[model samples]
Target: MAATGSVALALYYYYVRGETQRGQFVGLWPATILGLAVSLNLEQMKRMLQDFQN
Candidate 1:
């Protein structure tokens, strides 16, 4: 959801506001957030598996 919002905002900035540099900067945000989410989820799943084994 957050990633989608970031993309939308980036598009607005690029097309409507005419800020290419800023738009490109904002565009990177979604990938960063998604990477972080994946890492966190993997860590959480590992912990859950360990707990189940105990």
Candidate 2:
């Protein structure tokens, strides 16, 4: 959801506002957000598996 919002905002900045650099900067955020989400989810899954093993 946050990633989607970031994409929309990036588009708006790029096309509507004509701020190419700012849009490009914001465009990079979705990947970072998704990467963080994946990392956190993997950590949570690891904890869950450990709990089950115990």
Residue-level lDDT of model 2, residues 1-54, one tens digit each, is 999999999999999999999999999999999999999999999999999999
TM-score for each predicted model, relative to the true structure? 0.94, 0.95
- Taking the tens digit of each residue's C-alpha lDDT, what string does model 1 give over 16-51? 999999999999999999999999999999999999
List the RMSD of every prediction in angstroms. Answer: 0.6, 0.5
TM-score of 2: 0.95
lDDT of each: 0.99, 1.00
Tell how far residue 5 is off in model 2, in angstroms: 0.3
TM-score top scorer: 2
Residue 1 deviation, candidate 2, in Å? Answer: 0.8
How well does candidate 1 match the true structure, expressed as C-alpha RMSD? 0.6
